[model samples]
Target: MTGTDGLVVGEEVPEFSAPLVAPDADREERSLSELLSDGPVLFCFYTADFSPDCIEEWCSFRDFDWFASTSDVQVVGISKSRSWIHQQFIDYLDLQFPLFSDRDLTIAEAFDVRYRVFGLFERSKRSCFLIDEDRTVRYKWVGQHWLDPTRDVPPVTEIFEGVRNELGAPETETFGFDAAMTD
Candidate 1:
């Protein structure tokens, strides 16, 4: 049930709920249905927080103008990390999107993105799904391996293109991190 070949476009994603921690530290439980209540979702599942790749990936989304301005698309990040870890990452990156704690891997199992790295370390593989309001996955990207930088990475431009193709929005450009602001 866990691999890149599992889920596919046009499939209705299974439902799941997990604990979510907002940037301000507000904690609550959220479900996929509740998330779609607002609009379509660009759901991303990462391996963990505080990792270099994850830091760049999440920050790219935060810095992307389209991500911030696209009101019709709800952005939610999920990982196996705990709420405290999520809080630290959010604060450190100044992320505007809320992240969910999938500590139990329920959602990852449902999406079939759960996998083990090097055949030992269990974690959520980096994946993304563009789900419509009807719960059908319109687009998806699943990595082939754990920490495979070439495939497991989220290229900002490609992600934005997918977002535009799925949701039809303002154009996007590669979001570069401002080093001065990070300091």
Candidate 2:
């Protein structure tokens, strides 16, 4: 399917590589297979690095308590921003995940989430994909419209719950604070 239609659940995501800025500020090319090698992955696609919505979405992922508690899943971000911009953004937010630089929107196009904003500038629609070890998409979420004032990031808690139900809980919950403490 074309990028406008976006990928669907059960579709196998093709392996691709892109330049990325790691949390430690290293810039290098990384492939999807390398990421999947660790386990399942949650790919968060956004319009730009410093946009308000992008910041909010990434901060949520950075502070996601479930992420700290789970070693079975890795979360990374993709955007059209350059590697240096991604480094600054990651440092500004203290993000725990790497950010891929899809400056030409090639990766977003492959995922079918690339769109032209105001019918001019190319950008990635806010989207998320839960891809398993087999490279098959298990879950997908895309924002209704980039210009929609109400559009926001997908709910991390709900995604975490779905992952738990599908993959079962990790054997040990060594990270994150006690859930009871939040109550």
Candidate 3:
């Protein structure tokens, strides 16, 4: 499980800290390092929120509602929307995940998702990343920002079976050893 090409899979993921707003919190700041403390995380980036495709994509993640129990994976959607805007988006859509505001594109750039839209408009191309417990981006996909994300989360296998396999973390609670606390 390692980052490849421009994305690092086995190395430490680039760290960027910025203000983030959860469904209930205000303009609170959360860093990449902080988010990785608990375990793995899935980051879904798009042009913006409230767009038909974007909203539908979020709804799908919310509907799955399985990351909480299935793995250490926590889903976070990143976009140029303001924290307040994210709050409304989350509230209106009743998303059960966190949405991070990357208005400055710092986080987006760190993940190499930030770029000019159509070579003119500034925005993050629709992209998805699978970060391992060590914050390494083990999987990534960018392009087709307009595709129907309502269909599934990228790296679909992880969405269905959890990231333990992708990250090479053995199943322990049920398979035998504790997945976490192991080297």
Best by TM-score: 2
Q: Model 1: what TM-score?
A: 0.86
Return the candidate ranking by TM-score, descending: 2, 1, 3
Which stretches in model 3 have alpha-carbon errors above 4 Å? 1-8, 144-164, 167-183
Clashes of each: 0, 1, 5
User: What's the TM for model 2?
Assistant: 0.88
Clashing pairs for model 1 are none
Model 2 C-alpha lDDT per residue in residues 1-183, reported as the tens digit of each score:
254656988899988999978998889999999889999988888878888878888778778767755778888899899999999998998888889999988899889888776677777888888899999988877778547412567787777766666667656663354655333
- Please give the CA lDDT of all the candidate structures: 0.78, 0.80, 0.67
Q: Which parts of model 1 have CA positions greater than 4 angstroms off?
A: 145-151, 170-183
**By lDDT, who's the top model here?**
2
- Looking at model 2, residue 175 earns an lDDT score of 33
lDDT of 1 by residue, 124-172 (tens): 7788888988889988877665455223677667876687777764344
Candidate 3 at 81: error in angstroms? 0.4
